[model samples]
Target chain A: MSDPGKSSIPFISLITLFPALLLGTIFGIPHLIGEGSAEDLITLSGIGVTVTVTDLLFVIGLLLSASIMAVVYYVLVSKYKVAVLADSKTEELLKSRDFFLRLFDDSPVPYLMVAKDGEIVLPNKASQRLFQMTAEELMQYKFHELHDDAYFAQSRTIYDKFVRGVASSDVEFEVVRKDGVRRWVRLSALPYRKQGGKGKGGTISLLDITEQKAIDKVKTEFVSLASHQLRTPLSAMKWYGEMVLQGKEPLSEKQRRYVQKIYKGNQRMIELVDLLLSASRLEMGSFHIEITSFDPILIVKDIFEEVTKSIKDKRLHIIENYEGDHTNFFSDKKLVHMILQNLITNAVKYTNDDGTVRVSLTFSPDDLHVEVEDNGLGIPPEQQDKIFSKMFRADNARLKVADGNGLGLYIIKEAVESLGGEVGFTSELNRGTIFTVTIPNATEGSGTKSN
Target chain B: MVLQDTVLVIDDDNELRGVLQEALSDAGFEVLTAENGSVGLTVALESKPNLILLDLVMPVMDGWEFLERLHADAWGKGARVIILTNADDIDSLSRAIEGHGYEYLVKTDWKIDEVVDKIRGELGVQ
Candidate 1:
């Protein structure tokens, strides 16, 4: 098949006029030699016809020159158009480059382009504002110089790893301002490489998180103080009530009933105090896990027995599959107990009259999984996100029981997580909810799982 | 000469201390009570009870200080110390148990009778 472009337009091929000239010379020279050159003087014939050779030669030369000039004009104009197009493209690229440079300079976040050598390369106007120094002054110093001296060792190690293709570029760092005040900054970097795959420079954006850090510190302190102070007195209340209820003094029937009410009310107060303490410990990140090796199934059974009265009051059916040898995990007993208590209570409280509540324990070499599933008033899909949130109760749940502090799931989630386990639930409205907690069994070199 | 198993209750709460003293005495153990860690340490060293149920949060000297002082004395070493704490975190729990070789229990979680029972169990007494 012939090339499609080969037979297309010969007009643009006029730029190859050297070939055109070659053909013109080869063919014209032959024609001139064969036809002979028209030359000289005028001759008069008897019939009165006269002609000059110079006139005919001048006419022939004019036609040949016109043909060559047309091809030359086409070639010159096409080349000129190509040059203009290239120039326009260069101009567009320059405009875009300027726009992006201004955007970087004007961003609220401080931006700095850093070299693999830890040198501060290209710093924007915002970087100057953040560091309280001019670009010229900051440029001479290394990137880690802006960070607090305490961060030097770690920053150096991180930088070394980053360039060595081992570490992530995003990290939180502390920087001392020009005024000698420490500021928290979240530094995220975009690292790139050279064309040859060698590590190149990266750009970092610093977001000042000083205010956020301060707020977090205050929140932690408040939680720590409140939990300790509030629960101390409740312990006193609990013991005194239990003392009177179990005292050997003979009391009338009415008096005994009154004392029992007091004990129950005191018990409720203690439960509330415990809920608050759990919330505080979880929020302050001080919820301690003292893992002791114990049979998980035993703890589950004990929690079920503790909540038996509640189960009977609600008339809920109790289903237990706790048989055989479950795992003896090295885990925090108190935390696991709290988790089981919370989950079982939730199952009992949310379930309807005569609703089925099942407690199942399954074990493996690597992990132990405990699931508390109930055919309760299952949670709504929209409100599921708020289930683990503190003091959050579903609308249906609130209507059924008004006494719930709604900290049950929150405590369960925090306690289970403190044990280095995961807690998740599956629910359908008016059907049931199943909460599964999976904790890794520490049977190897590790002693106990604690947080 | 073997004697009756003696138990000491060191706690800040006047009511809880009184109640535990009454309960343990009823359980046929010689019950001794101290209001704070300062008096408790002295009493513990003097009486050398078989078991001591010490509450962690107390005035003057806390349970931790009492244990430190008790460990220093030769007589206090013979008694088995059990810290009954209201401190919620596990660090305090483990510190009370590991630091002094004491048994730890949460105050509200245990009934007054249960605390007495635990003391009796630790002492191998009725």
Candidate 2:
């Protein structure tokens, strides 16, 4: 491609004329040699015409100079047009660049461009406002500098990955401002390389999410409070039922049955409230972990005793299986109990009369495995994916039992997750469900206790 | 006359207190009732019941303050107190209760008979 701005048209035209001048001199020299003398009159003939050398030469020179000027004129005009087009293109590019720069500077979301080494390169106006510092002041700091020490270590890892040309999106981080106030932000970054893939850099954007976090906390607290408030009335009803049943005078059979129904209804309501409370506590991450060595067999036996009435009501055969040593087990006792209780309850509730429930405990050096298999109404295949979701109940399970609140499985999943464990289930339609849970033993260095 | 172990029931709910009183009296223990934590603390100091069924949330004084005040007295250090709460596993309270190895029960989860049995167990009334 020719650079119209760089090579001048006049210079090119002048060079073209030099070759023509040499040809003209060669033709004139031949005519002068054939004429009478070199200094005398010279005659030239060409193209079936005769003329004196001076007149011919003069006509040729005039024609050559005129055509050269025409060529030069055309070249100059085109070059002028090319130059004008190039100028406008450059101006448009510059305008758009300025517009985008302004947009980046004025955006409410904080924006930052960092170098390959995670050093802050260019911080936009919003970024400066977020940090309450000037771009110049922030330029010397790294991307993770604004985070607290614990978060700083984590942020450094993410920043290092970004510097290695990895992209990250919407990772939540808590950052401290210049005034020592902490706020939550979701940060995203995309890696960019220089032309020819030389140097690596990235653009980062942070969205302030402190308000959203606060609203979430408030919602969790409300759920907790509402559940507690519901429990008081339910408790009163339960005790009242107990008192009437335990009264001195024996009541009629119908009256006793009605009282029992009231008692059971209150009991169901109380269990629902408890599930809601547990779900909310799990959501809020407020539950504590107490690590103690206990026997899994003992826990299972105790749970069986707790549900002995239900077991007898259905005449369901209860089977216990202990695999391996079944001792030296350590985990969060409450969470383990919660997981097992929910599983066993579901097994008892959904199993048909005379159905069998197998409670299996497998112990290893590193983990404990619990399996509760019941010949009960299993979950529908299509809805199995949502079994562990909050407030999700299978179609068959819902039709079978009208009293379940659908939070038992969700609580189990959440509790197991918090204990750094895994839970899964296999079910066949109308046959049964076997829920299997594996919880890792709390090792010496790594316990499930998180405050 | 057979010697009966005295049990104090401290709660803000009148109906709950009455029912618990009846149930504990039927369970063969001398039952004392208080409407709130302050009253319960005074009754506990004066009567020195063998066991105390204390509710955590109440007007005038909560169960935590009552526990604190009760523990400040010399005789109260070894007093057996069973925390009965409608709320589920409050973080700080549960931690403190667990630290002290005190028995904690959710009121709704327990039946009257079960509570009586637990009180019997605590007082070694078998």
Candidate 3:
């Protein structure tokens, strides 16, 4: 026997080589038989030789088929790997697409994607609901489809500006819905561009502001109507009151007292009406202020002179404390008058007989601060906030005073704010209230002036 | 203060005008009345009244129009018009006195004697 390693190698090779060996044996046997055998083989060639040749051909064919199978296996495995990679890439793309779609769908504000030519490309669910249109229908339509012709034209202008990159933020507009419902919407848009500036598109967001617009409209109408109605009656009251007060007719003591009562009542009504009108104007941003450079001290002195008689009984003490060389500042003189009048009048109204009311004016380089301090029933903390509200009165003041309509402080606050000034107060129950007003100089046009 | 000096009351309210006439008569003055601004203007120009009580807010012609027309007329030059109006604001008062050249008196403050005294003052009666 050969060496152990060599013998083991042959055995292993034979196990793998059985088909090749069998094929070789069948074919080589005919050739090895020689001449006699060859003659016999020739005679039996049709059968034996054919069998040998067939066996050889089959062996060779099997070897060739194995080689072909190896090639096919390599090609199929590589193809499978490529297909798997392609599938995973497709799956990743689909996941990203779905994520963006979900984000667009879930956005709170109504969103619409429009092509460059104003065709609707996509609309979020909110957009569909707002316009009361189905997704399919909205995609087939444009923004003009839901608005009136006039508004549609306006929308085109705004959209054109957005396309040209001239406008960057949302613009407010009125648009009509498919159901003929008009609404106010704040529309914001972004220009969408594809790779290399090839494709252009726009995404628009619409915020419904109908409720706010309605509230403003109602406020304007109410102010107009109230002013007209209140002024008409106030005119009659003032005219008649003055006529009676002028002593045009002979009167007894009782008659004079009655006339005086009526006059006083009418005068109070006029004041109330004036305060109401002023407050309404303030809230509506229509209150007029004529800003000019004037001395705050002079204005305070003038106001004091005008209201001195009313507060004479209260022993009111008004002190002017102005800074040096800065007495002159820019401000609306009339508004200043009204502010001082309201504060001083309020002080007199709330102060007891013989109580003291002090008016002090303080100024700085950037601002003018006026403080009106009164020793009266101090405001309760709970009622402080409501004091600046129109037609609101403190409970204690309401119980004690007959002349106030709760509009004095409200008007004061409005007038102050309109002039770019601030009004605030400090009070302790049963102590006293001190109102402070800080206003910018007149050069800033803090007050509105009526033509 | 007598029949020679007639006081003209121009107002839109017929009831008010009638009451005014009666009150003026009792207060010892001859009174003439017109319901609208146009007719009141005609009456003022024709009668050459000692004093004219003009009411604003009339139907055909308002007090403003009447004042414009009356001020333009030669006969109405010397006539004193005490404006009977319901306007209370300083702007309206200023317009009446300065812009329209008239004295404004509110209706609610009206008294018979007061009206007569104003008329007497305008007429220069002692």
- DockQ, cand. 2: 0.62
* Per-residue lDDT over A347-439 for candidate 3, one digit per residue giving the tens place of the 0 to 100 score: 877877777787777777678888888888998888887888777888988888866787788878778877778999999877789999998
Tell me, by lDDT, which candidate is best: 2
Candidate 2: TM-score of chain A is: 0.65
The CAPRI classification for model 3 reads as: incorrect
Q: Lowest-lDDT window of 10 residues in candidate 2 chain A?
A: A36-45
Say which prediction, candidate 1 or candidate 2, comes out ahead on DockQ: 2
| lDDT tens per residue, model 3, B13-56 | 76567667766776677899998889998888887888888877
User: lDDT (0-100) at residue A33 of candidate 3?
Assistant: 68
Which residue window of length 10 is worst by lDDT in model 2 chain B? B90-99
Off by over 4 Å in 1: A1-214, A248-259, A279-292, A322-328, A390-400, A448-450, B1-8, B18-33, B43-51, B120-126
Docking class of 1: medium
Return the top candidate by TM-score: 2
lDDT for A280 in candidate 3 is 61
Clash tally for model 2: 0
Best-first order by DockQ:
2, 1, 3
The alpha-carbon interface RMSD of model 2 comes to 1.5
